[model samples]
Target: MYKFASTASIAAPSAQLTLSGSGVFIFQIGSALGTSLNSQIVLVNGALPQCVFWLIGSSAVLGSGCKFQGILMASASIGFMDGASLVGAAYAQNAAVTLINSVITVPPACNL
Candidate 1:
C-alpha cells in the first residue's frame, strides 16, 4: 500500500521512538520522492535512538496513503520511555535483522 525511503533526523541526546498508532516509517537512504504514495509523513526526520534528527527542509508532513483503518506512518522525536515500551512487545518477522530483539516487527499486530 506504500513504498519509499528517506533520511530522517530525530535530534540528539534523545534515544528512542515510537512508530505506533498504525503506520510504517523507515530510514534506509535517499530522498522521499516517488516513494511516498500513502504515508502520514512519508519522509521521517526524527532521531534514531542515539543520533541527531532535524527538519532540514520541509516540516509540513508529506504523504498520500496516510490515514486509514490500519496504517501508521510518521516519526517523532522520542526518548527511552518509548524504547522500554518495546520490551515484552510481541514481535513477528519472516526475516532477521540482528538477534531476537533487534528484528523488525509490528507491535502485536493490533495490540500489546
Candidate 2:
C-alpha cells in the first residue's frame, strides 16, 4: 500500500512495479527543479516482478517483503528491512542505504 502526494520521478530501470492488497504506487519523476518533491512509494506484493533499479533524488522506501532485481540509486538515502531483498547493485550517490540483514547482489552489468 503506497500513496504519493508530492511530485517525483518513478523509473524502474529494468523491471516493473506491481502493487498488492488494493494499493496504488505513485511515482512522479523528472519534475521541475524545485517545484515538486522527489519522492516515491512502493507497495509490497509476492506476485510482483522484481525491481531492476530505482533512480531517486531525495528518498525511497520499500516494503518489508518486497524484492528488487537490480540496482538502487538514491541521492539522499534508502531504507528497507524485514526480509527485503535486492538482487543487484546499490548506489547511494550522496547518501547511504539502511538495511537490516537483507539480501544484496551486485550484477556484472552494474559495472558498466
Candidate 3:
C-alpha cells in the first residue's frame, strides 16, 4: 500500500502511472486542506489501460477530457470534469458524486 498524508497530484504531462494488484494508493489532503484542492489524478499517456486508483483523500478530481481506465475508489467526494471519461467504476464513500459531460463505462463482469 502506498500512503500519502499530504496533497498529491499526478500532474506530469509526460509521466506514466499504474496501480494494480492488492496495492492501494492513498492520499490525504495536506496544506491545501478543506478546499476543493484535494488529490488530483491527471490524464496522461503511457498509462496502463486497465488498473486501479485508490484515493484516500478528502476528495478526488479527474482532469478534464481525460481518458482513464480502472476502478477509482475515493473516501469522499468525486468530481469528474467536462469531457472526462472513465472505462471503469468509481465509488465515493462519503459524499456526493458530481459529473459534467463525463462518461463512465463499466467493464463486462467476468471471472478469470
Better of 1 and 2 by lDDT: 2
- The residue-by-residue lDDT of candidate 3 on 1-112, one tens digit each, is 4556776555654233444443333434431112121223342443332344455456767766665666666778777877777777788888877889988888753232
Task: Specify the highest-lDDT model's number.
Answer: 3
- Identify the candidate with maximal TM-score: 3
Q: Is candidate 2 or candidate 3 better by TM-score?
A: 3
Q: What TM value does model 3 have? A: 0.61
Backbone atom clashes (below 3 Å) for every candidate: 16, 4, 0
lDDT of 3 at 13: 46
- Weakest 10 consecutive residues of candidate 1 by summed lDDT: 77-86
Q: Which rank order by TM-score, best down to worst?
A: 3, 2, 1
Total backbone clashes of candidate 2, pairs 3 or more residues apart or in separate chains: 4
Model 1's TM-score against the true structure: 0.21
Off by over 4 Å in 3: 13-51, 109-112
lDDT of 1 by residue, 1-112 (tens): 2222455433223222344333333333232211132222121343122121222111212222221111212223111121122221221122211122122223233221
- Provide the lDDT at 67 for model 2: 60
